[model samples]
Target: MDAKETLSGLPWWVKWIAIPVIALVVFGGLITAVIGFIVGLLFKVLVFAALVGGVIFLVRRFTSASSSSRGDW
Candidate 1:
């Protein structure tokens, strides 16, 4: 039979059982999303730290290089 015929044949208890199962599935999806968000935040923090550190290193190198060149002249 087609899906509509199969659903219509199911007893009332079938619908009741479906409710809690659907709720559990939805709750699982929400938990997965929260975990993914936390992991993404950690990755962003690491990337930001690396970028800031690189900029500071570059600025220090440029300042030291310029100061040494001026003394030589």
Candidate 2:
């Protein structure tokens, strides 16, 4: 009645290859969806970070340039 006793009688391919293939066939969609969501979230975070950095750089560049032009430096 134990799993080890049941699996021991099966062929090696059944234990290794068949079982894993069957599991993926059952749960593959959920696994793919979860992975896709994580990748998309990471991409959005990277894009937001780039936009914020660009804004900071432009602000600093223009502010410094205008102040120097005004002979404040």
Candidate 3:
């Protein structure tokens, strides 16, 4: 039988609720792990951007300060 015919033969609750619940029960751990990995990757990318920006700020500050001091040397 085709998918549409199979689904039509099932009860409404079975189609709407039971299938989803069963799917979650079967793959919940896998779904949670995949979501966790994506979140972690996003967090690490944000941290990397923040660190690079901080380094650039520090370099610019020091360079300007040293250039000003160069005239006194």
Of 1 and 2, the candidate ranking higher by lDDT: 2
- Report lDDT per candidate: 0.89, 0.98, 0.97
**lDDT per residue (tens digit) for residues 4-70 in model 3:** 9999988999999999999999999999999999999999999999999999999999988998989
Q: Against the true structure, whose TM-score is highest?
A: 3
Q: Give lDDT tens digits, candidate 2, residues 1-73.
A: 9999999999999999999999999999999999999999999999999999999999999999999899966
Clashing pairs in 2: none
Best by the lDDT measure: 2
* Rank list by TM-score: 3, 2, 1
Worst 10 residues of 1 by lDDT: 12-21
Clashes of each: 0, 0, 0
Q: Give candidate 1's error at residue 63 in angstroms.
A: 0.8
Candidate 3 clashes between residue pairs 3 or more apart in a chain or in different chains: none
Taking the tens digit of each residue's C-alpha lDDT, what string does model 1 give over 10-69?
887776798578887979888889999999999999999999999999999998999898
Which regions in candidate 3 have their CA more than 4 angstroms from the true location? none
Better of 2 and 3 by TM-score: 3
Better of 1 and 3 by TM-score: 3
